[model samples]
Target: MNPVLGQVPVYNAYGSVPALPLGWVENYTPTGQPYWFNTITNQSSWVYPMMTSKKIPGTNWLFVLTHDGYEFYYDRDSKTSVWEQPEELKEAMQELKKLEEEEKLKKEEEEKQKALEEEEEAKKALEEEEENKKRVLEEEKEQARQEVKRIKLDQAVDNAEDVEATEMTEEDIMWQLQQMAEEEVGMDREEEEEVQEEAQKEEEIKQVEKKPELSEQECIEKFYQLLKENNISPFAVYSVELPKLMLDPRFSLVPHNKQKNLFNKYCHELGEQIKKEKSQNTKKPENEFKELLESKVTTKMYWDDFRRKFKNDPRFKALSVTREKEALFKEHIRNNLNKKNPIEDYKNLLRHVKEIQKGIRWRDAKKLLEKYDVYHAIEDKDKREDLFRDYLDEL
Candidate 1:
């Protein structure tokens, strides 16, 4: 009935035998249709749709005479093979095609998984490289900072101010703070300056003399002078030193056992001396004061200053001064050593902390692993296949 599966007419020698299944026909698939024509057996079959070419016909086909297990035909013109038509075997052929498709799909999925894994590995490697770069940069920056300290130490500013002293003063920084507050609260300069004057005076005295040599007002003037010269912030100075002070010397006085009348009447005398100096040279007053202060703060001054601030404290008195000195030396050494990568940094030490605060550790890796899906597997036949690593996009 259908030309694709032609009817065979059973007849003697010359022509036609009519029957079920036995047939010979040229394939006649329309354009845009997919078919594989086996003219050998005068039969054609469909593979995946829209695959290959259509219509194979008008040629002699091959045959196997020895067994005839499954009939076949060959075309001398096209040198092609075709399967023989057998109506009863159609179901078996369909099953074979289904199995073939399954195999193909399985292979394709495996390839996709492999590609995915490769991409994930590449991505991880890039991330690791970037992290290493960042770590190296951080170490280099730390080294530079240490080198700077080494240079400063070698120069040995013994006759000079300590590192903190060369920095901002309490008065200079406080002035800026006061300025900000005044602007924020919309206050007049006269009121703010007046409030600041007393406070500043008291502060200056404690810093300059740190003993009975200077009074509160004189301290204020000295502080003011030094701040102006260095163009430093007074608040910043106080911020740096407040830890060492048993009490803020300007606002509150803690009369140490070693020093009494810690505030002195040096402001007017120093002011006059400054005025005379100015008459001789036009150099700025604050600059002169800054230089003088820096030159005067010797190592002896550091110990003396500390003693003055803490001498009255019962707690410090409880500790032996000899013991304190040893402790201080040990602390300095440890600080220097801490500038390098410690033994902990060499190992991947995991802490539960999500932050890298004072140390370098391997907790960051564990965290990344936990947050991402790493490996996956698929089962096919008797084999278990690793589906590869999935990518982690931005969280």
Candidate 2:
């Protein structure tokens, strides 16, 4: 019979075999028989044939046959060869799964820890904010308590004075009554009439003294004096201070309806006075600060350098608030350093004055230029007038 088609072709030794194909390799069996193996398909056979296989759809797997005649699958992508499935691949897959689970657990634990830390930080910030609020509230409470105590003390003093006055009046009345009784016991008819008339006159005097009235203007002045004596600020709340003010006997002299209006008016006047005094006080320091800047600072100098240079100087230290000092420094730079020609600016402003004439006095010219900012650029009135004179001569 003819040889079966595709029968095995055997080789005796490795060197006896022809050069293997690109994807085929030569191997030896236990009997020293040469065999052909396909690396891509994971197939082995004694016969060498040009064989091809289709890849699994959407996969790198191919159906392969082992040398032992067992069916298996081969992955060209991962290069995994197995009969059924190798125990090592399964064990490797299990190990890979375990590693993924560990990584996931580790990430989750880290996320939980991060979330807990954020929560703790937020809780700490909230607690600190609450503590600050509590501290401020306690401070306000203490201040209010002190104010109430001071008011009570003032009221107590007023009450004591009134009580003493009342006792003195009662003692005086009793003494007068006893004198009248003694005079009546020893008097003739004419003397009795005199004593009776005198007693009537004394009663009228006591009634007048008990109900003495003050003029409205005097009452207002008295109340104002009381406010001054107590050192009450113009910013003092009317409702809050009313109880303290009422402790003064003069507070009752004014009619209730007019009292509020009077209090508002007095506060307004006091406010204006305080404002004027504060402005005056502020000017001294501002002037000193300006002089210090002019003497020690240069146009090239910045605020930090100037402050460092003269921080210990009395003129620099005169301005207490840092912002105020910074503001003045900025203003000085804007007015003096930034100006290319301040005198020329002043001249231009004077040129715009329609009321200025050739022979106008410096005072009249100053009044006209007072409305212009450039006119105030020069701090000294005399120097400004001198500059105006120079400008006039130029004209």
Each candidate's lDDT (Cα)?
Answer: 0.42, 0.68
- The top-ranked prediction according to TM-score is 2
- For model 1, the superposed segments whose C-alpha errors exceed 4 Å read 1-84, 87-92, 157-395
Residues 237-349 of candidate 2: C-alpha lDDT, one tens digit per residue:
56656656764567767776577678788889999998999887776877888889888766445677877888899999888999899877767765763466667777776
Give the number of colliding residue pairs in candidate 2.
0
Per-residue lDDT over 121-208 for candidate 1, one digit per residue giving the tens place of the 0 to 100 score: 6658767996897679668756765675577455644523445666668996787567556554543454467557856975896588
lDDT of 1 at 11: 20
Q: State residue 215's C-alpha deviation in candidate 1, in Å.
A: 71
What's the CA RMSD for each of the models?
Answer: 48.1, 40.5
User: RMSD of model 1, in Å?
Assistant: 48.1
TM-score of each: 0.21, 0.27
**Where does model 2 exceed 4 Å of error?**
1-191, 203-219, 222-253, 260-279, 282-286, 298-308, 317-395
Q: Highest lDDT: which candidate? A: 2
